[model samples]
Target: MLSRGGAVENDRGSFREFVEKQKQKGTLVLLKKPCSLSLELAGVMKALDGKPVYCDKIKEVPGARVAGNVFCTRELICEYFGIRNEELMPKLVHAINNPSKPELVEGKNAPVLEVTEQEVDLSKFPIPFHAPKDGGPYFASAVGIANDKEYGRNCSFHRMMVIGKDRVAVRILPRHLEEFIKRAEGELEVAFVVGAPINVLLAAAISVEIGKDELQIANSLAPLRTVRLESGIEVPADAEYVFEGRITSEMVDEGPFVDLTETYDIVRKQRVMKITKVHHRKNPIFHVLLPGALEHKLLMGMPREPTIFNEVGKVAECKGVNITPGGCSWLHAVVAVRKKKDDDGKNAIEAAFRGHKSLKHVVVVDEDIDIYDPESVEWAIATRVQADKRLVIKHNEKGSSLDPSADPNTYATTKMGVDATKPLVAHGKNFEKAEWKAIKKEEYV
Candidate 1:
């Protein structure tokens, strides 16, 4: 475990600082060989999908580096926050419930403003063409930050494809960013932040009420500082790169890219954004998040855990929630609860779906079962579940579009909920597993 002072030093939300710390811990793989931005960079990253990797040499951009899989697992994220696995739920819930505003600093104080680009050419950076089927070189990790008169400030992730020297097509869903664009009459000044801290990235993916600033939640998670761009858009002061732009009314094709399900998403006409200015720290490290990979899944799914915990707590004592990776971390979840009544598991299943609307299947188990372990969850199902009595199925429900089996047009599919909690009163068989005392086998040998 890291000391309190160490956590404080790294809690300011600096991506470069986090990378250096990982390197010092001997967990980061340093690749000194020159690599291409086309496919080689992403290919290497995919090959080492669950490990942190840093590429120091880039063929396209001199003095630029790329880092991937920095936060690919829950253990890495927990370590970054200086917390244990069990504490993550409460920490996120507290941060969301009590948000604090970040300290605003001038451009001179912000390290990201140390260098300003004379011309806006995105190709000069290390943006990777992840796969052959991708429409274009994509920026899968950039967080789009925009301000709204009615909703204050909003931050969300948008996959961007480089279309020209100074333009990119962004896939904007019907979320806060779209609302902000609509309020501004189809054009809004925005900032795309690359290489943000883990706290900021996690907070941006959280689905909170409108008018609630995600940056504030990030600040509550850790000490964070913000700097305003020339367009008056605020971004993390310690970010590696900040692209100031305007999401224009123009629409263009965007997709054939891999999504959360590791499947190709259909092409759609999305909004185009024109970059007006670019700011970065000296020798900035670009963050490349491979689509449908571990890092992507964790970022998209972990934030939803707190929401599920909150909803499940209303009816049962929610112990833990795991958005299992096998479900692509979006469509399936395993929830552990301390059952107080016969229907607690079933109630938790219903509430879990309510917490994450895109969830297609859910399993509710007792506290004894480890929600994070696939085999443990299956064991609970095998021992405690009876399909006729414990299964809850909803037909023709709105599900995730990432599920290829669902109707692509409506995202409609059948949802299943399995109550795999053991009965409070066992009829004949013992629900608890047998235990024994520990001994040192070396003495006997």
Candidate 2:
């Protein structure tokens, strides 16, 4: 997180700075109307289609404000990082491969611990009910920070449903957090941080090797200053609300909430967390993430882009990679490559599948094709692709659990890869589009 301009230039130090920058850029939409966490706010997010917004008034939960659409688009991410979106993958790849350790500071110096409440009450915060059929108000943007003595620190996102005043039912997937908690004797010390930096959020979402510190990756992306909580767990110093808690050896009903696939996930008995202390700044803003919306999709999908790029780079000169919005940014992808040989496209397609195991469909195209544009990718597939020669299908492969078409029991689905690159030969020029004379816009008008 190097400063770009000068002393006054925005280095995106904290989530507050990021929001302020968005406000100045006229990209942060302020919704002043009294909003409800139940459906009103979620409805607004759906209507905006992941437009960055700031809400000053929450009717249901008084004195609590919120911000959303933080990770809406690649351009928005580019603006935050002060780089072109085209450079994002390379930057993330570098950060993931070569991580920088974070500096641990005292909680006294952190703004998040400015006000600490010993009497923990989850209802005090404006935790939004994102989906219509959700069990209760969920902290979807809450990034959980946990540590094991042997395994070290772990940062990851988990959905926490407000079941009681100090109790939250968390849907703990079988990941690093789950593994950390399992290794513990009784309860695992955890800190659920809200309104952390975008870089921290992205780092938490990525799946690094077990025992690897995701915080280090975050520090590589941007300086991630952490503070020790009362529970001895470390969390982002600039977080809006830091709920020091422990994952109790208790199971509770969670979910039936909308998942990444924009469908209701099955209700299950999940782990319960007992929040012991709540720390916050003077006036905190809750970062809300709409379930199954663009924010959720991007946060879950974009981290994989860099991994895909790195994997494809091993085999081909990968130009760009885009996780299509239409595919929920998880089940599908489009990879652009500077095709040196006829097999470059096919190699990239296979490498992409390896990069992202959940990917169900992939399209590999020439560098001339705009991977971001569905129309352009489709054109390449229509003109350059042959069903028999270009299509590669792998059936019964382990895919995303969110994919409804996949076997729910096994999470197995068929994966397809389409090599849409033109044949590399003397007659390859035949596939090029006919040249049209360039016209001046003013003259044409």
Candidate 3:
């Protein structure tokens, strides 16, 4: 039953190309079970444990099939960017700093416009209910696209909850989209792109200077081809689904939705999006992102790695960075550096905090330690850190709003950093882990 939708021949720029590439690599999983959008969050979360595989087999929603966990791991992201695992952060930082302009094509040539809904109805798609606290079924995988005459075009992920057949309540933070909406006199033209390519998704999440077009960043990672909508908004030509809409002046209660911190965000009056035109490819596979899951954490955290790396580079030879899932991948970070001076660890800790202001705690480790491995990072902290000498703390710092402990009104909290790098006097020999001689496992078995 799950194997019904075979490979859809795709152009070079379509998201289906990436899916087909992953499928060819044997990393895509097709689930055959029919699942309720609200009830299946846990099942999808469980299926993505420690692996980044594409899963499809949702049949519960009307007029759609659903898939999830498209960018859950570094390996998958590296695959999409055509880079090696170790080159991920540097490459991202470079691409973000230097972006390529996007190429635009006519709307009639786009696959997303292959079918257009005469009447705008969002309920026809299986936008998942990710958590019990969520107010309604929300579009968790959407990368919203909007344009400003000055800013050109902007793409970012904004949670949209389906409130009516053609209405969605969008949680708009003070960013490019909000700025663009403010620039627009009445209603802001927008496009909620579902199932965008991996590059586009990452580009949307990055924090860049205002007036910087994220589509160009997507093009820097890979050549991004866009199609002009009837509304004049440009979207990735190969997106699975595109909802051309407008951000209206009307406001609605839009929260209690799970955030990146895996906490229920309080309800707030947010702007509403009135979808005008719904366009999609034939037999489109709906992309659903489980809120507060690994997918959410990775997408939110990985983009920050470059910022942290670039900041720490000024003070030390920054090796790598890992935003731990335990820290909600937003409020905590682990930075690895090749210790040159005795204070390089401490310097890196301060630099990292500066890189991401929302960080509440940071741990700096030696080059020998693997930042991705929690146990290794913990070991470095245990063996090398002296609380009185290595600890750095700041009071009443601006922090993540998702942190339950922070003052919600001000988004302020205490922040700390730990210098877990070994002393320079030791010459690193004493800190090395004991290793066993290599042997053939086949012989022993």
Candidate topping TM-score: 1
| TM-score, model 1 to reference | 0.97
* Better by TM-score, candidate 2 or 1: 1
- Itemize residue pairs with steric clashes in candidate 3: none
User: Highest lDDT among the candidates is held by which one?
Assistant: 1
State the displacement of the C-alpha of residue 330, model 2, in Å, after optimal TM-score superposition.
Answer: 0.6
lDDT of 1 by residue, 24-67 (tens): 89899998778898889888888899999999788888878889
Ranking by TM-score: 1, 2, 3
Per-model tally of clashing residue pairs = 0, 0, 0
Candidates in order have lDDT scores of 0.91, 0.87, 0.82
Q: Which ranges of candidate 2 are over 4 A from the true structure?
A: 1-12, 426-429
Task: State TM-scores per candidate.
Answer: 0.97, 0.96, 0.92
Which run of 10 residues does model 3 get worst, by summed lDDT?
A: 1-10
RMSD of 2: 1.8
In Å, residue 74's CA in model 3 sits off its true spot by 1.2
Candidate 1 collision pairs: none
